[model samples]
Target: MRVSANLGFLYADQPVTGRIASAARDGFDAVEFHWPYDVPPEQLRAALTAGGIQGVSINTRRGNLDAGDFGLAAVPGREDEARAGIAEAVDYAARAGLSAVHVMAGRAEGEAAGRIFVENLRFACEQAERHGITMLIEPLNLRDVPGYFLTGTDHARRIVAAVGHPTLRIMYDVYHMQIMQGDHVRTLQGLGDLVGHIQIASVPDRTEPDRGEVDIRWLLDQIAYSGLVGAEYHPTRAPGDWLRDFRSSS
Candidate 1:
């Protein structure tokens, strides 16, 4: 199974560019990013080329942390900001040679928030299609991110159906789903093509997959997903050490 290192969590000790090199050295097939807007696209592209690995995906910018904005897409009265973030993400992903962008749904609720999310996603999909990029929406666990708009697979699926756009799809994260719901294998099999990306981390503690309650290797073997599986875990030690151990065990 091919794996992508999630730069946001793994390799927290290094800079973004350094993390790319570290991921390459650790035998990762690719890398994924979260809020990498601070790094210029050209610089990131060069780093990826030098590391000899591809950048598979990145997240749209989080609006304002101080204001407690986790994202902008699903928030009512923030359509312009959300669309701008979508445009920026699409353009950056194109320039950085990334294939997908995960659009974050901010802290929100009620019917109006849902309506705004769907409309913003439609606009995002339209922009992404022009560049041959896919738009992803992930269901974050409310415990980790309270008030996060998207919090369950079924809800995310409904949103995708509402958007009815080819480029828009779900990012199924094992850790979050395991917290909100169990039966990972069945859920993944059921989602099928609606899933555009997959991410994994240990449940509850959010540690390396090998050290968690879940049988990650078994889970991997049961699934027939042909895409890169993101290792989005918080490492207890050097990430390379964890990867080496995981490789040997697998």
Candidate 2:
């Protein structure tokens, strides 16, 4: 399976361009970014081309993150802002030659939030499809982001079914699922068809996957055929050693 580096955590000390190159140097086939809006599209494109790696995914802007706004898509009466965010992300992804966009569901919850989420997602999917990109929705564990609207893979699956959009799919994050529900192998087996992308990190500590209670290497091997796995975790003190272990195990 292909491995992608998540620049959001992996290279905290480097510039975005440097991080892209670092990911390629570490043997990652592709890279993902969380809110890479700060970087110009032209700059990102050049970096990816220079690094000889694909830009696989990027996240829709999280509205006012410091003001406690994780996302705007699921929030009531913010449909306009959410759609704008989707449009911006879609345009950016297309310009950067990315394959998917992660639409954050924000902190709102309830029937109103769910309804708005579906509506926003359908709109987002339509926009993404025009650019040959997929729209991804990930479930964040409550312990990590309490009050998050989407907090379970099953719930995300139901939303995808309800929306019934081919380009709309779930981003199954092993780190979050391991904390929310322990039976990952079975869970992934059941939801394999609905998953659009996968991300991994060590459980409890959210560090490199080399050492963890969940045997992350085993998990990656099990789902290797399903899709690309993204290394979305904080770096250990010895980032190079951690990556070496991942390369050796893979």
Candidate 3:
């Protein structure tokens, strides 16, 4: 299982561009971003080329944080903003040579929100397909993100099935899953090809995988995915130190 550093959390002390170089220097061949809109695509591409690392995936812009907007995609009456964010993310991912775009389903509920989410996902899938990029939707845990639209593996699967688009798939974050539900091994194994990307961090504390209550290494051994597993966790020590320890122990 190859691991990619999640620049959003792994190297929080450095600038995004510097995080790419740091990830490369630490032997990571791939990295993922949360919101890199502040960084120009050309600059990001240049940094990735210089570091000889691949930029794997990025999330769509979360709308108006000050206004309590976690995402725009599923919010009623915000279709324009949602689609705009989707277009921007897909375009940016294509320009930066990223393989996928994660569409965030904002804090919403009821049948109306569900319908809006499906429609937005279809739009995102269509745009992503034009650039040969995959579109992903993640289920955020309610504890950390209360009122989040998507919060379970089954819900994500149903949404993907409803869209019926090949480019659209689920971004399974183990940390969130562990919080919202247990039985990670069975859940992931059952999801199979529906899962487009995977992310990991410790449960309850949101720290290094090795420090979590879950036996991450053992859990990883039971899975059969060949794609890059994102190391998306906050580190208490130097990121490299925990990485080395985790790898050596593995």
- Greater TM-score among 1 and 2 belongs to 1
- Rank candidates, lDDT, best first: 1, 3, 2
User: How high is the CA lDDT of each candidate model?
Assistant: 0.91, 0.88, 0.91
**Model 1 lDDT per residue over 169-245, tens place:** 89999999988887889988888889899888887799988866788888878877888889999888877787788
**TM-score of model 3 vs. true structure:** 0.98
Q: Enumerate residue pairs that collide in model 3.
A: none
RMSD of each: 1.1, 1.3, 0.9
Clashes of 1: 0
Ranking by TM-score: 3, 1, 2
Better of 2 and 3 by TM-score: 3
Who is ahead in lDDT, 2 or 3?
3
Off by over 4 Å in 1: none
**What would you estimate as the lDDT of candidate 3?**
0.91
TM-score of each: 0.97, 0.96, 0.98
